[model samples]
Target: MIKHAALVSFLMHLDYFDAGNMDSFVDDLTVIPAGRGTDAAGQIVVCEMEYTGVYGIADYPHVQYPVQRLLAQISAWLLDHDTDRTTPFDFSVNVETNPRDDSKADLEIRIPFREAVTASADAGGELALAGEHYDVNA
Candidate 1:
């Protein structure tokens, strides 16, 4: 599972928008397990994970362009981080105005990742869970 703080830090590092505006732009970040699959040995070997969040952006007259650019940057980052360029990632985004604060709008995003988990033996011959590999299309 990806740590929430790590993901937030990554977003702040992106150049699509000023990092100073992050606190106002992002409301929440969550990582959840969507599904799982087993390998031939009946061991859980694959997982479907999701990163869901709401971005509360200030309602500038031209908010859409910056939001769109930010999404593009996120997509590129996901692709670059993908370990396996095979399966496709599922990404969804929705934009809407905040109910209580008309001056702020919400950019809801759901990013899905398919991860492969395997068991490997280290030099000590102890079996250990290897690192996860994201399955994403090239």
Candidate 2:
């Protein structure tokens, strides 16, 4: 299981805010369909709703949501998918930063249209997991 705490810290980095020493890093990280594909963009969209444990209801201006919140969201998002995977998933949007390995380096997600996970005779309905040859089909 990916360390929720660590992933949380990493996501925080994406926010581009100046919150000091937020803890958003992952440990024991693993990927579903393991090593599915290469880096593609515009797959995920984020709707950051809060910052520094602050959420809004009425409305605020120029609010900077904590980056870690988004990271945690991504960690949670990965948990929802099937490890074996199914069909080509077009996109995965979240307020979190994209996942990474132990070093906090980006673990490229976002497969392209063509590279998008798909069913195959050999692999069955299993979506392509990360693989050495996996390039974003898009």
lDDT of each: 0.45, 0.31
lDDT of 1: 0.45
What lDDT tens digits, residue by residue, belong to model 1 across residues 69-89? 766776666667755436344
Per-structure clash totals for the candidates? 0, 30
All-Cα superposition RMSD per candidate: 8.1, 15.7
lDDT of 2: 0.31
RMSD of candidate 2 to the truth, in angstroms, is 15.7
Local accuracy of candidate 2 as per-residue lDDT tens digits, 69-108: 5445554544553232344343343232333333242222
Residue pairs whose backbone atoms clash in candidate 1: none
Error of 1 at 135 (Å): 22
